[model samples]
Target chain A: MRVPEVLLDVRDLRICYETSRGCVKAVDGVSLEVYAGETFCLVGETGCGKSTLALAIPRLLPPNARILSGSILFKGVDLLRVSDSKLQELRGKEIAMIFQNPMTSLNPVHRVGFQVAEVPVTHFKMSWREALATAVRQLGRVGIADPDLRSRDYPHTFSGGMKQRSMIAMMTTCKPSLLIADEPTTALDVTIQAQILKLLHELKNEYGLTLLLITHNFGIVAEVCDRVGVMYAGKIVEVADVTEVFEAPLHPYTKGLIDCVVARRKSKSRLNQIPGTPPSLLNPPTGCRFHPRCAYVTHECVKEEPRLIEVRKNHLVACHNYEKVGGVSWSS
Target chain B: MELLVVEDLRKYFEFKKGLFARKQYVRAVDGVSFSVERGTTLGVVGESGSGKTTLGLTILRLIEPTSGRILFNGSDVTRLSKEELKHFRRSTGIVFQDPYSSLNPRMRVKEILERPLKIHSDEGEESRVERIIKTLEEVGLSAEHLMRYPHELSGGQQQRVAIARAIILKPLLVVLDEPTSSLDVSVQAQILNLLLDLQSRHELTYVFITHDLLTAKHVSDFIMVMYLGKVVEYSTVREVFSNPRHPYTASLLSSIPIPDPKLRGRKRVSVVGEPPSPLNPPKGCRYHPRCPYAIDTCELREPELLEHDKKHFVACHRAGELSFREFLADMDSFLSE
Candidate 1:
């Protein structure tokens, strides 16, 4: 398969929030690229700053979050330096986002059809009548039953699955080049989650849209993503092809996460849990953020941070003891 | 011997539409029956509106059940007086899904643990404090954590504190409603292991309620699958996984995504359409609308749960004729190889 052209290029992205205690380094020095028609997944635990890095790509951070340094270049235009009006034009047209919670993100007072039509009417300058028709078509496209009748209903009338489909329809109606889905199926049940995931896969192929999926569920990453980046303490500790990362995870943190999940899944006995918790972002460890809980931790691990080094053609690892810690190879 | 027995449990909430209007009853948990043996786990699996939580709550009498018999150690506590009910509740505790919200935000961990002991027993405060510290240690928290509030702890630690409180009273049964659903996988493992260890140590019977099939399989000795406030299937964990009788159970097990990437594109039965509303369930078999093997007779009569084998019960009329063994064999092949 030929690699699609790179549509969004993020380099050295750093974001910090001004808190009373100190400056919380939410996203620190993250760099990656999303190809034109591929799914790039950011997999990590809660509070790992994957969401913050995603928000930084679209310049959607709040007023208090300072982008300390870095550049988000999308289609040759630096999103950090774009004018407010130009950014507004690019938001819904060039890039669209689907948030974690669809209920809160959707406008409660408006009808579902009008809320979905809001994006196309505002961005493409389509008339209300035209946008309404387009919105109904998009709803039907997402496998929503009786779109015409249901479109007139409010968000409360729709089930969790339908509301999610509406959210997806709203995000994709404009046919944006890239879609950012941050935990889109977290609020849904397994059955509904499967449906939504299948819908996203079909839509991505149908529309030829690049996808940036941020989720903590590794199972989802394995199913949907082409390439995966494992984040820890606001940094991309490992980045590789989806199969390679799952099969041959190199970083200690990635290995721990995989082991933790795999162990719990296989044994009817007690799960082999990873000791300790994720470090606080406000005062991260001196060197590697994962060094505190790493089983193969060494003095060097605490003294010098490991740079992401290519261990294979496409696999990267950011651990000092990657070559030596060899009881169980992640790559089966 | 039956450690906990619930027969024909029903909990309905009445809503009035107008000042002079008739009342509308929301049948949250309508006529559910099951029993748990001593030192065993009975898992209740269902969808969001399937009333699994309401059933657990009703069993504990946290909310009054409209009519039922909750026999704990051969004593029916449903009709107990307020004083007797308070005493009965101390012997049967509950752990909620969200640990952060369940624990009082303003109270320290120590106080949270001690409040239960203070209410139920006449033990001195000093001894209760020691018991609290010991229980905290058992759940993997330290005495240092005693001074921390719920906000200061991580999700896992707060859940541990919640478990410590539930077990401090030495309850005969603990009703865990999706206890680990809100937690990360690693933290979920820790909490689950803790629960198992505590169960063995205390010889406690547990009614674990969750929609997660994997967790249910790992924790429960017996599993009951519910749909639209009805028990569709009930059997041993091994039997349910190896030979699921009901169509709903088969669909649910197949819907769960195995963590392994090698088994990604395997073929399995996937149930289509969402669950029907409980307010107005379908005629006859509530599951016939989605059942792939539905016959005309299914829509005309509801199937009663019958004993297909010793300790295995199924409610589908065609469950005996269905080839559940073939389905399990296919799933095992996909998962294993």
Candidate 2:
């Protein structure tokens, strides 16, 4: 068996925001590894810290946010300890990130092609003329029809799907190995979303990219992820192969989420919903953050946090009562 | 019996191309017609610029239609006078897509739900309070939430308050426009189940407008597919999912990403491009540019919606000649080594 090379390894990452009320633990002690040329997904609800953990890898947290502890090693180099100028050199050329909203990400005043060309020009010190040529080719490759004419057009003229395609074209200009897409298709329509997902899949294969896809939608996870990580509050509760995560989810939180999506396909039966809202991150629940909503909650879950432990081959679950949790088989 | 029937409804918003160019009409709801039965849901599924929300609002008379008849309970709602329209609105309700923006942050839950009652009813204050309490309980909220402001409630609880406000008058028809799109799956499931339970208990006719296919399939008895402000296909939910005739409908059904890795590994039939702009929609069929099976005739002439099978209507030039399921099956096998 060929041993997969580790591309990005994050260990014990604890990110927090110093607000007026208190310090909000956005991502608390998250440790995961992204293998080379594999798509790893972080699936969770809103404010679950999946985005925080992803942003921290690029060292792109907001001003108020701080990484209290942990190390982010990309290709055996510590990204957290790197100099600001060194990080900037590596940002667009080696590690790139795309945001959820395409409208705000690109400057509305500039032509779309110029913005895309700026990536290579700034990162690699390429000539503007050559980079612009590359920009047009990349635009065409991203499925933009009439690239020559559309490339000259402003961002406002591009549709939502077109803008996202342009964003992808711009991001891939440097041919970055690790692409962190945070809710890439959340703003698109269903058909357009399908088109973008297909484009991302094609690009992943063509570039041999290591993708860290963050989304709340399970369907996207099932569609693209090779492995899945189920995050709650600020910690990952379960990590497994894509099929195992769906077929035999060990954690109760993971089971509840899968059941929510699958039960809808079986006609008008009452949907099984997880009771209670996600706890506030200001003072996240003492022990397991999901224990308040977990069905198999016990006293151990309330008093102590369970570290991620391998319950089976390559299947890790962070729950004290994995033995008690029911298996969730895929119905369809 | 049909609780709500719309005939040849049209809404056109006029805007100038440039500063001095002649005014052109954006045919938002160019020509739409459908009916909701007494106690069943009619799901309106479409992408953006499809005018599903416009149709919903036009039915409620929030936006006056340019032409056509809106018959609610056997009366032309468009012809009603101002006072008569006020009375007509009491029989209908609407829930918007975002609960965060829909509910005023400053107002307490009690005041937000109480506004609808005050506008429609002339009952005493004591009775109005009693009705509000009862409606809150029905939507799974207790009296504790009544005094709390909208910001203090969670998204699911806020949506429940929105539902409670919509049904507080005991309206017969409710238009829910993407009510659960902004929620988590678990919370979304709770809201959907609550809607279904409320629907059966109150015998409410619903026009559920959403872009989520799974949620639509769960709650709707009938599904309506719209493109560029026109109904492309209309049929029972079973028929639409099982044997879709229109290329657009087939593309929609095929585009839905099912939550299974095995199916994901199999080939998916993705429609090629983005939807065209509403202002400059294609001449013949709006979906022809993106459809996989578009022929020369599809670009030249529009197809009228006609019954291809029993109780299933489709607007396509080649509705029955091509089998979409066979196409998908062939694609799946053809792509897999």
Which residue pairs show collisions in model 2? none
**What C-alpha lDDT, on a 0 to 100 scale, does residue A187 get in candidate 2?**
92
C-alpha-based local distance difference test score of model 1:
0.86
What DockQ values do the models have?
0.46, 0.55
lDDT of 1 at A312: 79
Model 2, A142-165: lDDT tens digits are 999999899999999998889999
Per-residue alpha-carbon lDDT of candidate 2 for residues B171-240, written as tens digits (9 for 90 to 100): 9999999999999888998999899999999999999999987788888889999999999999988777
Interface RMSD values for the candidates, listed in order?
Answer: 3.2, 5.3
What would the per-residue lDDT of candidate 1 be over residues B214-276, giving only the tens digit for each residue? 788878889999888889999998788888889889888777766556666755666777877
How does chain A of every candidate compare to the true chain A by TM-score?
0.96, 0.98
TM-score of 1: 0.96
Query: Which 10-residue window in model 1 chain B sums to the lowest lDDT?
Result: B328-337
Give the per-residue lDDT digits (tens) of candidate 1, residues A84-116. Answer: 999999898889999888899888999999998
B67: Cα error in model 1, Å: 1.7
